[model samples]
Target: MRAAALKWVLWDVKDTLLKVRFSVGEQYCREAERMGLSLNPVAVNSAFRQAYKSYSSRYPNYGIGQGLNGHSWWTAVVKDTFSLCGVQDSALLQTLSNSLYHNFCNAQNWEVFNDSKKVLEGCSSLGLKLGVVSNFDNRLETILKSCDLLSHFSFLITSEQAGVAKPSLLIFEQALQKCGVSAAQVAHVGDHYINDYLSSRTLGIHGFLLDRDNKYDRSEVVPKGHRLNSLEELPSRLQQPMD
Candidate 1:
């Protein structure tokens, strides 16, 4: 029998191996009903998402100027979103923001991708070392364990734990060190172009983009790595040599 030649495979969790359902808006709306706010949960969810994006993008500039970390930035965004939704209770909004930590930890509503377990199992059978590098809070390990996928990974690196987020080479270097593989022998699979593709390429490690949104089809941003639509396509993609 031939042994697997690949040294390591690194994966991203959210929107890559798992489908995250944001239920905080629904919970907030339900609580709002008790407080007589009467806002639609869907609208709240959309507004929250937009606010989050705006805040996240602005943070590197405005946040550092204000000396805020990632958690503080997101908390402010959540409070702003709730305020925009006509939520007037300061205490309730604080509780809602705190609730995110609980939701992420439990993740009872989040689901592993349909092909995630199968793909990981296949990789294990092939004797490939597996790891995860994610931009998440402290609950990433609990989330993966809840889905029964933790055992497949030899290393799990989260931005919260690493004190650095994706699109940063430091976190990627940490994953490589833990897996004991050179950049050339490692493949990093993730769903975001900037975080997953550009960052890995900067370090000379192979990067694969999971473009489920088809947003890149019209863009001229040719990735330095393979592009795949699903986790099921990973094994075949990995089997091919790097170009």
Candidate 2:
């Protein structure tokens, strides 16, 4: 009933641990300029969202279920994003897609939250194990390594590796097996409600929904313990009960 002493803290990558320093539009426009093309960042960004959504809906989980790897899946999204912006050059789009894909592997494009490292350290100091459970590609390991955060985690279970994405209980089940821990012994923190919170909570893991922008109103419920405003609150929160 006391939740197995919360042996492990599973983290979500994007928006939870770190974020891209620039918007997709900015990254796109900058890459275009490097290739001697001119484009509006706003237009490019809007196109990226549309292309990403369409691709995700059709090919979901980088199309791992459809014989497509992360590289090919993302290349399609990038190529189509530029195509939607009217680039109309096949070779240029392909080259740009390749550039963008590899560029994201290193830490230069990402900024780890100010509180991320401290929380990770605090969790370790608490004698709790750490790991990552994200809906990311295999590039996740490289990305975290480049950021120097990979050493903190005991293991990383990416959706690309799990053959399923979050919001589905299968991914979390895989994570549980990897940690060799029961659902009651883990806590999962992520930004999305359905994918990160509800899904993990459904499996009896302590799911902490991170609402950094105050997007979800506190009056909605017992926000004091149910949701987290920052990673800084996690160490203490873990000391409390799930309810």
Candidate 3:
């Protein structure tokens, strides 16, 4: 058997592999309307960003062994999001939370990037093991399976399962142990600069920043050649000598 060029490649889920078809605020608006709360998309979106940040900051150990289940963690975010939008009724918040959570679970709401599948296949063809290290919840497995992306990965490690989020060395170390390889033998690809690239790099893992949209200003932040414009470019980049 041919020796694998790299032992494994870790991936990030949201924005990296699968993306929501509509804006978060738009999704919140539609879900809110279903729960009888009429809200402006712009206002709801703004409120959601703030609410989510506040909730996440408050509950650092949500959803994995720290005592919060998926429903509770997500419910808090949804409830806070609607409350900030001025809908204070508990009944409405509960209903909206359930609706929003399940709605997002449906695969139709997400679309995989055009280059995602082919890139995974390319890495697999190169005899590299693949895994996912994400900050999302357990529903990710269902989402990946629903999107037909589950087969390519040898493992999926989420912050929820690992008891910590990205940029946390513990989570990255958890992935390293799962793959049974040293940091130098692995590569993680994600869209976030600090969370995905720098975090992995700090742990001695080769990290590639997937900048599909070209939205980030690379000025003095990331060193040259570490930025990837698309998943299709990954294979060649991985073949080059690491810095």
Task: Say which prediction, candidate 2 or candidate 3, comes out ahead on TM-score.
Answer: 2
lDDT tens digits by residue: candidate 2, 70-103: 9999999999999998898899999999999999
Question: Candidates 2 and 3: which is better by lDDT?
Answer: 2
lDDT of each: 0.77, 0.91, 0.86
The model with the greatest TM-score is 2
Q: Residue 102 in model 1: shift from native, Å?
A: 0.6
The parts of candidate 1 lying over 4 Å away from their true place are: 1-4, 22-24, 31-37, 58-74, 218-225
**Residue 190, model 1: Cα distance from true site in angstroms:** 1.0
lDDT of 1: 0.77
Give me the overall lDDT of model 2: 0.91
**1 against 3, candidate with superior TM-score:** 3
Index of the highest-lDDT prediction:
2
After superposition, the stretches of candidate 3 with alpha carbons farther than 4 Å from their true spots are 1-5, 61-66, 217-223
Pairs with backbone N, CA or C atoms under 3 Å apart (clashes), candidate 2: none
**lDDT of residue 243 for candidate 2:** 68
